[model samples]
Target: MPRSIATLLFLSVLAGATPVLAQPGGTPMQLPRTISVPGSGSVTGTPDKAQVRLTVQKTNPSMEKARAEAVVVVQRFLALTKKLGIPEAKVRTTSAMVNPEYRWDQPTSRQVLVGYSVQREFEVEVNDLDKLGALVEGAVDAGVNHVAPPVLDSTKRRELNRQALAAAARDAEANARAIADTLGVKLGSLRELTAGGAEPPRPPMPMAMMKATMAEAADAGGAATYTPGSLTFDATVNASFDIVSP
Candidate 1:
């Protein structure tokens, strides 16, 4: 058909049928009755555990000399933990790396091998939060040259998650009911539900005890103060429900 004839026929057909209701702005819209709601809940508690990373590095002219010194230092670190009453099961070597040190030789305009560096890292889960500050100080004094800021944790994670989830569910149900009342409808069977959230917020929110622990930390004259701060764990849930006649 010609463009003009096709346009005329389309208008004629629309005129023959009853126009379904349009949303504001004359945009045609249709849908089955359903409501979706988003809800979130949180529970707060004190952190009772700490996760810490400790590192020892050694550089020497010979690769064997550097590696041997690194191993001895790591053993002393493990021994310190045992002396502190921290169980051996809680500590493990996380990474070991040996890299060749390079120097720019301006005369030759090429990189030259200067030495070998051996680095070892360990991950420790300390169950006793009270001893966290002391542990960091002791570990640093013992041979740890690098320490990532300790990550505070709790033993009651499962309990907190359950509480947060329950609160989220109740929150979702309340929202559904409120919408149903507004629309003069009864909230019917749940069509779908989903719950999700991070275990702990990434780059965990700063707690009171967090401190800068660079190589200079070991040289500090006094032990650093540690404060285990309280944190709230949150959970989010999305729910969909059928809207039935009241």
Candidate 2:
């Protein structure tokens, strides 16, 4: 988050007098008198949606057994999501693989094969923010051992971003007007404009919070409590206004 916010003004001519340059054939060309400014805006709103990543891992002396156990856990997770009314498209398998586990023996000075490990990762998107805590709890109870921090988001991100941009444009115009007045010049029509796209807000999720949430889920059995914080989208714009009179 930024500590301060202000529009920076850049004036083409500080004295309100346009500079003249000699062109070919001894023709004099006057530079355009304008006020350019950069402006920023931010919009904050509550998140109505969330996404979480879960992984199921299993290890056994036999490679086949480890792989089979992981598959079963994954199947259970999928069934749970389906039962919770989550669309199949929203629940996707990100990765699935099996690898050999090894341990080093100090006395023998060699690596020993301990077992085989199998892991599968899944990403689930939940539209109902209220169901996020329950979904995470259910996944954990269903043998999902690795869970990433849930990402909070809004469904109206696109519209909010546009609103932020509009605010930024207005700020730029206000800055140009102020600078023009200070220079004793009358503002004219807009000469040029450039828009910078809005930036997506990143929700703050500390590791301690995640751990505490999981612990509470294990103890409570029911849906865990969750708070969907607000998200802020920031946008910037650069605008130039022509100098009509001085």
Candidate 3:
């Protein structure tokens, strides 16, 4: 109907004057009563693994020369990893691209083709944190010109998740009981349990180590230094508990 009538109806419902529809037998249908609560928990541990993405880029007037130079740089990086005793399985080339370089020319009022650029990117997974700094230094020394910030990881991620989930479950139960006690009602059997909203922890938190820029890596002279920090895993759970008269 009109807005005024709709508003009045809603206000009346809030005032506990809602109209109830009768069933086929003329009895009113009642909805099941439940209380849903949200809970969250977290656990922290040290990171024991890391990954680094390294890239080699070359640009030249000739596409052939650019491609050849990029290949040589990539080979050097791979050979260095091999010498370091890193397993072949943990290393893989991620991407390779060849594009024509263009420059905006003010005199010609048009884009001018300058050269060809060839780039190759690869990733290395390091199980030993002690070797992380050395690995990055070695790659840069081998002429790998670009280095992305390292991503620190934990070997016990599954265990941590389980612990966090347990904590979250307990938290949810506690919340339900507290609400029930406040409402002067008893909490009956669990109607539903849903786990969601938990995500893998991101980097740059306190004590977490993300490396410096490519220039900083090259200037370190010796093996680059890194401070492995603690990582926190979190979990959230939504629980529905039946409401019963006390």
Return the top candidate by lDDT: 2
Q: In candidate 1, what are the lDDT values of residues 1-246, reduced to their tens digit?
A: 568755654443333322234679999654335668998898887888788888999999899999999988888888878877899889988899999999999999999999999999999998986667677777766777887877777788889988998899889999999977765567788889999965854233243335553234446765555656676789999998876643
Write one digit per residue (lDDT tens) for candidate 2, span 181-228.
887789999999999975677684565775687688668775676877
RMSD of each: 8.2, 5.8, 5.2
Full-model lDDT, candidate 2: 0.82
Which ten residues in a row are the worst by lDDT in model 1?
Answer: 12-21
lDDT of 2 at 153: 86
Better of 2 and 3 by TM-score: 2
Runs in model 2 lying further than 4 Å from the true structure: 1-12, 106-108, 210-221
> Residue 64 of candidate 3: its Cα lDDT?
98
Number of clashing residue pairs, candidate 2: 0
- Model 1: runs farther than 4 Å from truth? 1-32, 202-223
Candidate with the larger lDDT of 1 and 3: 3
Clashing pairs in 3: none
What is the Cα-based lDDT of residue 57 in candidate 1? 98
User: What C-alpha lDDT do the candidate models reach, one value each?
Assistant: 0.76, 0.82, 0.79
| Candidate 3 per-residue C-alpha lDDT over 1-246 given as tens digits, one digit per residue, 9 for 90 to 100 | 668755754454334343344579999854445768988888998998988888899999999999999888888888888887889999998998999999999998999999999999898998987777777777777888877777888989989888899889889999999987776667889999998646557463222243453246557555666777788999999998877643
